[model samples]
Structures are given as structure tokens and as C-alpha cells.
Target: MRREIKYSDNYLIKQLPKATAYVNRDLSVAHISDSWLNNFNFSSKNVKKNNILKAFPTLTTKWKQDIDYAFLGFKNTTKTDKYFDSNIDECWLEWTILPWFDEEENVIGSIIQVADVTENFLLKQKLEKLEILIAVKSEIAKIGSWEYNAVNDKLHWSDMTKIIHEVADNFVSTIENALNFYKPGKNQRRITEYLDQSLKNGATWNDKFQIITAKGKEIWVIATGKPLFEDEKFIGIIGTIQDITEDVLAQQKIKESENLLRTLINHLPLNVFVKDLDSKKILVNQSECDYLNLTSEEIIGKNDFDLYDDETAQIIRGEDLKILNTLEPILGKETIITLKDGQKNNFLTSKIPLFNEDNDVVCLMGFSMDITPIKQKEEQLKLLINISAIQNKKLLNFAHIVSHNLRSHTANFSMLLGFLIKEADEEEREKLLEMLIDASDNLLETIDNLNEVLEINTNPVQEKKNIHANTEIGAVLKSLKLLIKNKRTHITNQITEDIYIKGVPTYVNNILTSIISNAIQFGQDISENKIEISANKIKGYTIITIKDNGIGINLEKNKDKIFGMYNTFHELEKTRGVSLYISKHQIEAMNGKFIINSKVGKGTTFKIYFNEND
Candidate 1:
């Protein structure tokens, strides 16, 4: 049989599996278990009977004090500390130090136990870091989280969630009280529905709605919620809320601006259109559609080539291309278009390039206006200017004529009277008296003619009627028949009876009588002097020609003065030099033209042009 061996208390303590050590009152190591040696990387000879603080140089002063407290019979104390082993690897230690009792229950020393808690300590640090990260992110994004407990009828709001609501940190909120933070009507009702759906059907919800903050200010928020479940039973709801007031208001303003612009352009009277880079129509206002005689649906997506002739389309396309390439605007470009109905219209058009954020031409905007009426008015203005210039020249001639004729007649009368008063011979005195009387009659006749010229000048417009040229010419010839006989002049009237002219009757008779009388008077020196009259229609005018073989005028020398008053070509007692001047004025007043062809001895020809009548 084997001998029975007894195990002592020290041997039994050294065999313990935990890292345990027994120390004396002086903190000297009395005994240590096998795990204790392994944990500290020590052997029995190095640690037994050695001071515990000296054997483990890593133990801090606080650990020594706690061991001393255990010697005073205090309850067990536990502490955790960071440690670096011989290899400098990081470790965490949980030390439990308690007093050891003798058989009489008196404390003798302390027993210290240690555990390696490195894994648990690292996990706890990670959890703390993650919580800090979540808090920072929530604050930056203006987002917050909340949870509701149906069992306790309580609501939990995170720190950021309370801040979002503008509530105190110590604020206590329940589910009903939390719902009150939403706006009164629609927001509150919607939130309630969302919660109900989440609770009953375990659904998730996301919505954007309005809310009232604790300060009684309204704001916009985006909210999301998900039902919480445990063992297939609904328990509560968890969700997130974010403040989005600025974003929501900005979107609203953008929409309102778009609507206002649409209303303004649609109601304008000018033609407005927008086109893409390809010259295809994108947008057009009502006025543009009306001008094109097409609806918006028909015009959109179409180019100039689809709506206009090839020539017009090419012109428009060229302009659009220039604007896009140069990024410049063409303003007030005048264009003319001939419509399908053969009517021509004028337009003032403008086109400008539209740019994108990168300062690139993306599209073009155009405006057009009809300017045909303005162009017509300009043409009328030019015609009026020509008429004004002609009237001004006529007035200047009349002024010079009046002043010159009056002065010449008065001087002649003065000299003739002086000769009559000084002559003693009755025959000579009577001759001077007759001469003075003739001068007086000439002056009176001159005054009457001047008065007629004044009337014509002041009233440039005359009432015109159709007069037969042949009958009028016959009447003039008969009135001057005695003079024609005395002058031995032969007059031939070849003006056809069917010919008619538009003129004032008085002006027509005056013109004919002056020309015929002049022919008869000037032909006295020529034997069988002949005058011929003829008429023919040319263009829009009836041209009457009067040819005479008489004392012809030197037109090259007196061309400028031929139609001037008191400018007589021949030295004759009856030549007053007023008839041709008056006749020319009358012709112009009737909107007719007077042209003269003459040579010093070859003869003279007068051509009068009047409007041709039916």
C-alpha cells in the first residue's frame, strides 16, 4: 500500500489555477500560485519571500495603498490598470486585492488576484469613439434621432434631437407631447398617420413636412421612421428628423420666379422665341405664334427652313450661326419679307446668344417687330420735301419781279412828264403827253399781272376741270385773228378734237393766248410767217407743241432769264416780257411742265405737257 501524504496550505495555495499571491503586512511576497508566476513571467526562487512591489516594478503607488488597506481588514478592492509586458505589448489588468484571515479571524496579510482584460477594454474604447463620431455627424447635418417606448409611454430624444426642437437639455417629453411640436393642422395630422401606420403595419416612412419649434417659429423638416419589433411584436418606433427650412424656401422661390416669367412673356405684344443650338425652336410666346400663323405645337421643334422659303431661311440661319459662334447679339436688324399673298412687310429683329454656366453659347433668344408703317411714312416725308423746295424757289422769283418792274415803270413816267412840262411846241408837248399816258397804262397793266402772280403764289392748289384742247386752241386763234392778219401770220391748228387735258379753265386760256399773241407779234418782220400747233399722248402726259417761224430767242445766251419778268428779248414798243413768265407759273401750278426750244434765227418751239385724261 502507498503511504498517505498530507498537502500543506502553502502547497495547496500554490496549486490554484488563478493568478493569486499572498503578501505579508510589509507587502513582501509570502506565496504565489503557478498562474501568478506565469502572468508576471517569474519563477518561485525570484518571487517567494521577495517584496511584492520590488518583484513587480510595474505596480503603481495606488496599488500599494490598496494592498495596505486590505491589511486593515477592509472589504475586497478591485482596480484596472494598463500594463506593458516584457515585450512592450499593451495589456489591461483587473486586480482584486482582499485580506487573508488566520484561524482566529484576524487579518495576517493580503491576497491579490489579477486577470488579463485586454480584449474587453479595447472593445469598450471602440464603443466610446463610435458614440462621439455619431454625435458630431448629427450636429453637422442638423439631424437628430428619437425613440418611443410603448410599454412605458415614454419618449427618448438624443441631444441633437432636443437641440433641433429648440428645447432645454433637461426637457422631458412623452409621445403626445412630442407630436405637438409639429404644425397644428396638416403637419400634425400627417405625422400622426405615419406613426399609426408604422405601429400597426410595422412600416417605414419618409416625409417632408412643417414643424413649429419651441420658440413658436415655423420651419421645414424631413422625417423618417421605422417600427421597432421584438419577437414579432410591435414595441415602439425609431426615426430621424432633419431641419431643411432654407432648402425648402429656396425651391419655392425658384418655382415662383419661373411662373412669373411665363406669365409676363406670354402676355407681351412683341414676338419672342427661344431656340436650341441646332436652331430648332424650343419656346415661343403667343405673339410669335400669331405672327407665324401657326400654333405652338406646330412650331416647336421646327427650324427656320421648315417655315420660310429657302432664301429667307438661309439668311436667318446665317445670323443665328454668327451669334452662336461669336457669342454676340444682333440688335435692330431690319429685314423685309414677301408674304405668300404678295404683300411685303418690314421687320426689326434682334437675336442674342444664351449662355450656360461655363460661359458657352447654348441657345439663342429672338425678338421681332413689324416696322412697315414707319417705312411708308418715311417715303411720304421725302415727297413732301421735294414739293416744299419747288414752292420756295417760286416765291423768291416773285419777290425779285415785283421790286424790279415797279421801279422801272415809275422812272419812265417821271422822265416823260418832265419832257412834257418843259416843251413849248404844242406838237412836241402832245407827243410827250402821249408817251407819259402810255407809260401810265403799262404800269397799271403790270400791277394787275403782279396781283395775279401773288394769288397764284399764295394759293398753290387749284381746282382743275377737263378742257378740250382743240376747241380752246380754236377760240384763241379766232380772238387773235386780226393781229394774225396784220402780221401776215398763218396759223395751223392740228390739235385733234379727241384730245383733252386737265387744268383750271382760266389758266388754260391764259397760257394759249400768251403763246399765240407772242407768235403773231414777233412774226411781223417775216413774210408769210407760219405757226403750227399739234398734240400727242406720251407716257402719262398729253404733250402740245407750238412751232413758229418768227424772231426766235437766243436761248444759249438768255436761257436762265428766258422765263424771268421784265426780260424782253426783242426791242419792241409792245414787248412787256411778262407773258411767258406768267404762263410758265400757271403751267407749274396745274402740275404741268413747260419746255422751250429756240435758236437766234432758226425759230422757237414751245412744248407744254399736261396730265392725259380719259
Candidate 2:
């Protein structure tokens, strides 16, 4: 057995409280501390030369390699203190072997030191895990820390902190030096105030400010600071800094974009607005106020109820709430209250919900356009469609009636001629034959008139043809020379000779003839009648005026029925009513229109609109 010695007897061994066993090259336990026996359950007897493998069979090969290296005069050292079985609480001990020599200078057995470094190994593992955690959190937060020790007057910065400051390697730092990096004025004063508060009141602060870097770059930063402590004694202020320049600049750009959008909307032709649901305040464009004939201040910040009846106000509020709840847009025709005089007007409105930063519906933005003219046109179209349908049915029935009557008359004439041809006596036969011939001629004339009426009804009333207005007017005047001479009607054409209109030439001539002949026929009881023709071009159409000193229409009683077929205002048998009806249809088919302006006992004016050949 080796002599037992106190662990404290060797200063080197005593310093290693966790060191255990020392084995030699011969596989003998030369040194074993009390810690080794208690830790591994092994003593000198259990760790003899021949029994070394038997005692710790798990460490046989590793121990033999150490002995062989020691015998070769090579130092064998190892470090391993790993937990093999966490459930069993089993750990390992590492070894170092060194050869010992006698006075003859020949190596014998080597000395081996075994150490138990489990606690320190575990502590090192924990520190590595902490470093990994810090790195991960710093990246996620975009934050970094720094501190200046006032007592030692030394500065320290974390890796992430230096990266945030955009500082160069040559830069030197101290408490005063760091504070000086803040931009002058507001930023510097804010940082000074926070530092003072931290020192005087042990306070913590969070602020955003601008800083100038060593590279002469201005950056926006958010910083937080709190007083640091060691053993209940204040040392200095420790804090974190984050680069927020991109975020700040992005916010500024958003504000500018919003301002530009507002300018565009205010100047648009349509009215636009946003309304806060909670406050009921309207954010409207300048056009909205102008459209309502009111000032912005008068219409803003007031609910619809203030400017409208209870029913209308409730309806608008309901619609707004519906949009808010569904977060969908409202589109269609609507009526809105005007701020001026509180009149209700129609609008084509579309409204959508506007969400706040959190994606919650906060208000509604709406666009509107005036559709009053369209509404009126829609009503007029409804009436016209009804009239057209009625006219179609009546025209069909009238054709059938005319055809049946004409066919009956022709059949009677044919039967009379056949009977006359069969007469026996010469005188009687001659008289009967003459009567049959006369009847046949009369039937032929009636059929010709009927066929002409049918042709007028079924022909394509208009075609696209450029007509020289002045040339057509001259031709009509030449045809009406006899009437003009007998009536002594003085006519004046105050129109440019080069004026032309896009229309059917025949229809244009027919319309001009009808108007001119009517003026001649319905002239006032005067020695001489006067007619004036004039033209004015507006937009894409020409307005032709035919003013006549004739007995005017009694518009109060005859306005609505003036264009109806077979309608006659004059009490004259010659008024067949076909000419005016044909004229109206022909003019309409050419995409032109006619209107009469007249008063009883006053001269009449017929205004015709024709495409100005633009």
C-alpha cells in the first residue's frame, strides 16, 4: 500500500479541490486524494497495477494509452468532464500523465493527475447559452447597449451598440463624448435632461432623437437609459440605442403623399369627403362645399341631421353604419342634403370604409357626382318609349284599315266593268262602258294616293348626306315663287352661304319646305308678310331659326299634341296632318330635332337642330 498523505501536504494538489487520482506508468495508483475515493468509489488497493483494469473496466484502454505514453517519456494529458448519464448523475474525470526519472536518467513510471471539472464545465456551457440568447434578442430588437463608468472614467460598448452608432475604429468615447454626438439643440437638450434625471432621481427614460456620427451622417435613434447598480452603489447609466432613421423618414414621406392626395381631390370636378364616425365631422374637398353652395366651415363637423329632415338624416346614418359594419363599399344613386338652404339634391355616390393603423374601421371616405341631368333624361326617355310603342301599334292598325277599304273599292270597280262589257244594245253598252271607264279612272287615282302614303310610311326616312343649306334654301324658294308672289311675302336669308349640315338631303329639303309653306299659308292679316332665316353654330350642332310673321300656334292648348300623328291645330280641311307627321319622323331619323316657340297674336319661330358637319 502506498503511504497515505494529507491532501493539503502538496500545495499544487491542495489548490485543486476537485482533483482526484494520480496513476503511474506501471498502472499503479501513486497518488489518490480523499476527493477521488469519495467521488469514484476507488482507493489505492482497488487501483493496484494488475487490478487497474478490473477496478475501472470502463477506463481500461484509455488508462493503458496514458501509461504507454508516460513510459516513452512523452507527457499524456486529457481533459474530459462530461455528464454521461443525466438520469444516473454520473460524470467523468480527465487525466494528465508525466514521466518521472531516477538519478541514472532512465525513465521508469510516469505521474498522472486526474481532475474532476464537472462544475466548471457546466458553468462554461451555461455562459455559452447566455451568449447565444443575447445575440438572438439583440437582432430581433435592433437594440444595443453601452455604458461609461464614471468612477474609472472608462467607456464600454457592446458589439451591436457600436454597429448602431456608425462609429469608426479611431473614435474615442466617454460620457461627455457620447452626449456630444447628439445633434445640437433639441436632441442634445433632451439627452441632457434624461441624464440629469437618471443621476438625480435614479430614473429611466425612453426618447427618440437625431445624432451625428463620426462619418458625418445624421441618423435618427430611439434610446432608453436606466441607472446601473453594483452592490447597492450607483456606478453609471446603462442604456440601449436603436437606429430609427428609416422609420422616421418613411413616416414623413407618408405625410407628404397624403398632402398631395388631398390637393388633387380638392381640385377634382366631383365632390369627395371623409367623415369621422365618432365625431360626425366631415373632411370634405373644396369642390364639395362649392357644389353645395356653402363654405367648408359651415358643412364640416356637423351631422346630416343638422342639415336635413329626420327621415333623411336617419337614412344616411343607417347607410354609414352599414358600411362600417361590413367594411364594404356603398355604390349607387343617393340623395344628400345640401349645407346651403338645406335642400336635398340627387347624387351618384360611392362610399368606402377607411381603416386606422390597427385595421379597425374609423371613418368613411365617399365620392359623389351630380346626376340631375341624367335623371331628367331618364324620365323623358321613359315617356318617349311609351309613345313609340303606342305609335307602332296605331300605325299597323291604320295600314290594315286603309288596305281593306282600298281593296273593297277596286273589287267593286272591276265587277262594274265586267257587267258593262256583257251589255247587248250599242247605245246602252256605250253609256255603261263610259261609266265603267270613268269609275276605273277614279279608282286608279285613289289607289295612287294610298300607295304614295304607304311609300312615305315605309321608306328609310333619312340617310347620312352633307347638304349645302344655302343651296337647298334657294331651290325651295324657287319652287314657292307663285305663293311668294301672291302673298307678297318678303323673305330674308341672314345665313352664311358656305354653311353645311350632316343629314339626309331630301329630309332637310322637306323640313325647310314645310316650315316655309306653313308661314306663307298662316300669314297674319297684313299687307305683306315677312320671314327671316338665320343660323348659329354651337358645340357640334347648328341652330337654324325660321321666324315668320304668321298667325302663331296657341301653345297653351296645343303644345303636348303638336307632334302626334294626324294632329292638326288649324281648323282647315286641307290640313291632312300627314305632312307634319312625316316631317317630324324624317327629322328625328336624321338625328336632328325641332322645337316651336310661339304665342297667340305673336310671330312664330321654328328652331331646327342639325349636325354642323364638324
Candidate 3:
């Protein structure tokens, strides 16, 4: 329903006295002032001639009896109303009704005045809640509040405060009594001085002091006070004080234990230090001073930059900042530091971040432990390990080649001798003898190959030269001419004469000879024997690709053993299988990569990558 808006009460309300309002004994809509009408959203056009209960449905008609009683010459009647409005939540109203009279002193009507007590009522409610909460907190925490009013010259203390002071519940408080409660010595004088200066300069203070209670017992307490102000003018001091005797004693024990630990650490032989977020040194022990060959005074307040060279200092500072940001500990950081005297020292260091109660990194604490002797021992072990690895590797390869070759030779001899024993003709015996000689020769060649590998490893750092690839390929081809003619092999060489790579000449020749020979021997199976050699430079490395139409090795079945010592996949040709293994090692030693990619029926492709710098 749309209610009609009205403002007829505005003119009549403006004619009333400051707060004049009188209701007839009916307790109907009394005259309301313009201020009250504007403030309370009331209007004569809306509320006049209406009962009080109907105008503001929150009221009771029972108030009309009090209005009638007040008009019967009784004293003014007062009442407070508390109710909830749908729009305004909680509302508090107070009204005072007095007997209204004419000049003839006859009681006529009841004059009523109203006050919106919402603010004061809400404040009273909050204070009640706070008092209950304070009571709970005080019991649990042993803390209390107090205030001193300089103008009234009175000191007020909460119940918790009185209990802390060990005073009677009804004890009369005075400035003299308060001051006297402090121990007759420094506590009294200090508190007196603090209060005088605090009042004079309006300064705040927070300190721990001992107080002599009413029972003459000495106890420590933390007292904090701030100058109370009204309109920017200092009035008095008010703050909280907590009995901190137990906390103070615990802290003292902890401090004593910390001192003992610090002394023990300083005596031990470790270089320990503390630094702030800005990398400024905060603490350093005797060992750190001795290590730096400087007094503590010289080392303190200095950062890594002030003590070490820029590069080393920056490396250290970076780690420090990382710890500060992460609040994490970094352990076992090893580095070599060169000092101002040009003496290099090896140190194993660690850092940890210090934090406050809020878990924010307050500072960083780290220690540098000299590990020169341990590092020296480590280097020695590494050198021995290197020598052992090299020797073990060469010995293994030698054994592999020797075992395969010796077995081949012995088997050939056994077969030949058996054939000779069974033969009746002298011609057959002579042929078997010749075959034995060939077997022994192959064994000797295998031994020679082992020797060559030994030499290569003995001087692994053999000096290399820039050699032309096409010339090397041509030489290998010419050397294998008889085999190539036997196999009916066709060769295609695409290497430029000027295209160069760095490698040992003997090794390079051996690699090309072995690969080319394999191509010719295996390509003999194909109807048309074919081989192609090409080279290109990509990304500073010379890449050589060798392709051939041949019976490609089935890498799927033998992939794992392809470069292993004495490992062979083919049975069509007599082989000792040491070539591929040694070639791979030698190529890698020269900072090159060796790759072979092939399929079962498709031909084989070998790619070699040679580093230009090598």
C-alpha cells in the first residue's frame, strides 16, 4: 500500500517551546517539537488524533495511567523503553512526563519529553561485554589495567590489579600509598621519576620493575603507561600492567644458559658469524677473528664485500640473500676463498636464517669451516681414481681382444691337426700346415691391434693435426683396392680435398679403413656393391656420413653390444670385433661423436661428428 506523504505537523511543531510536549490524559499524539518531528520522522498530518500505541506501534497504552497520575499532582514519572524495529534494529527511548499547569496552578495535562538513548545504551552494552571478557582474560593471563587522573588526583585500578597488588578489596588508594607499595629503593625512585617526567613531557614508558606488595613480598611486574590526552592536552597516564615474575625468572635462566652456550661456542674451533639482511656483520667469535687474523673489532660490522674480493664476496652475498628470502638453511657449501694476503683457503660453509615470532627473517647466521686438509685428501683420491680407471679400461680391452683371438687361433689349430691325423695323403697334410700358419698370423695381427690400443690410451692426449678428409679416404680406398676389386665394390667419394678436421692421423686412417672394409666385405652379398662418403659442416662440427648398399647389421638384436669389446653380430666374415669398440673410444677422446643408424634390409649409415676446436 502506498502511504500518502504529509507535512502538516511542521508548522504547529515549530510553535512549541524548546522541548514542550503535553499529552491529554488519553496518552494520544502529544504535541511534538519541529526538531523532534524532523529527527524522529513524525508529522501532525500523519500522527495527530492518533493514539500513542497506534502512532508508534512499539508503545503500550499503560503509559497513559502514569500520565494521568502525574496530572493528579504527583511527581514527574520517568520510564525507559527498549524495543527492536524492523528497519532500525535496536532502539532505546526514554521519556519524562510531568504535570502540566496553567497560571492558576491547576494540573491540566501531562507534558512529556523524549530522548533517543540508542548511543548511550549501546555503549553500556559494549562495556558490559568488555568487562566480562576482561575478567576472563585477567584470570588466565594475570594482567590488569589501571588509570591515573591528574585533575581529580585519583588512581583507579581494576579488580585484577588490586589482586596483583595483594591489597584489601576496600583499601583506600592514595598517591603516597601507591608510591610506597614499590620497594623502598630503586623501584620507588624510578617509578616516581618516570611518572613525573611522563606527566611533564607526556611521554610513554614500558618497563619491568620489582614491587613490594602490601604483604611485603617482592615480585617482578611489567608496567606500561602512556600519557592520556584530551583535546591534545595531556591529562594523566593509563595503561596495562602484568605480573611477569615467572616470565622474568624464566628469561633470566634462559639468558644464563645462552651465555654458557655462547662461551662454549667461542672456545671451540669454528668460524661462526651472524649477519643482518643488509649483509652487515653482527657477531663474530674468537675463532673467526683468529682465522681472519684480525681483532673482533675489525671483523665486526663488516660484510663479505669489506673483507673479501668482489667476486668471492658477491658469491657469498648472493647465498645470504637467498637464505634471507627463503628462511631456509643451506648446508655444505664448499668454495675456495682467496684472502687479502693471496692465500687460498678451502672452506665448507653453511647458513641459516633467524626469525622473529612472526616468522619473518630477522637475520642470517652462517659459519665457514676450513677444510683444507680434507680437500687435499679428496684431490689425492681423485687422482688415484683417474689413474686406476684408465689402467682398468685399457687392461679390459686388451683381455677382450686377446681372449677372442686366442680362441680363434687355438680352434683352427685343433681342427687342422685333427684333419692331418685323419688324412692319408701328404698333400692334405701340407695344406693343413699352411692353414695353421694363416691362423697364427691372424692371432699376431690381433695382438698388434691390442698393442696399438694400448699406445693410444697410454698417451690419450696425443697431438692432433688438421688433415684433409678426402685425402684420408682416398688413401684408405687405395690401400683396400684388392679387397674392393674382389668384392666388385663401387665407391663414391664426396669429401672436398680442402675439408679438414683435427684427429690423430693413425687413428683416422684406422677408422676409415675399418668402416670401408666392412662396407666392401658386407656389400659383397648385394648384387651391386655400392658405398658413398660425404662430409658437411654444421654448427662448428664437421659431420661425415658413410652410406653403403650392404647386408646391414641387425642393430635391433645387437644394439646393446654394438660397441662392446669383442662383440660381433655377423657370422659371414671372420672377425675379432675389437675395431668398433676402440674406434668409438678414440673418437670420443677427440671430442667427437660416433653414430650408426640402420635397418634390417635397408643399408647401413654411419655418421661421425668431429669438433672443430679439437
The best candidate in terms of lDDT: 1
Most TM-score-accurate candidate: 1
Q: Write the per-residue lDDT of candidate 3 for residues 207-307, one digit (tens) a residue.
A: 88898888888889888888888898877788777888888889999999989988987997778999988898889888888888999889888988888
Off by over 4 Å in 2: 1-19, 22-25, 28-78, 81-83, 86-123, 129-142, 163-165, 262-331, 334-345, 351-366, 370-614
Between 1 and 2, whose TM-score is larger? 1
Cα deviation in Å at residue 189, candidate 2? Answer: 2.1
User: How big is the positional error of residue 310 in model 2, measured in Å on the Cα after superposition?
Assistant: 9.1
* C-alpha lDDT of all candidate models, in order: 0.84, 0.75, 0.79
Span of ten consecutive residues with least summed lDDT in model 3: 1-10
Off by over 4 Å in 3: 1-20, 25-38, 61-76, 82-90, 98-110, 123-158, 192-207, 222-242, 274-283, 295-303, 310-335, 348-367, 371-614
Candidate 2 structure quality by residue, lDDT tens digits, 1-614: 22334555444553455644455545666555655556666654666544444544556677777778777888776746443432456666576767765556567566656666667777777999998998888877667888867679777877777777777655667778788889999999999999998888889999999999867899899998888888978888788898888889999999999999988998897888888984265788888888756788988887777656777778778889888888889987577555435566678888889888999988888888888777789989998998788568657755764676578777877787787778778898788778777777756755664564556557765457777888888999999999898778999999898788678787788889988887777778789999999988888787789999787899889987676545678775467455565677667666678889997767799988986552
Across 502-599, the per-residue lDDT of candidate 1 in tens digits comes to 78888889998998888778874756999999999898888889999887999878999988887898998878788888888888777788888987
TM-score of every candidate: 0.57, 0.46, 0.47
Rank candidates by lDDT, best first.
1, 3, 2
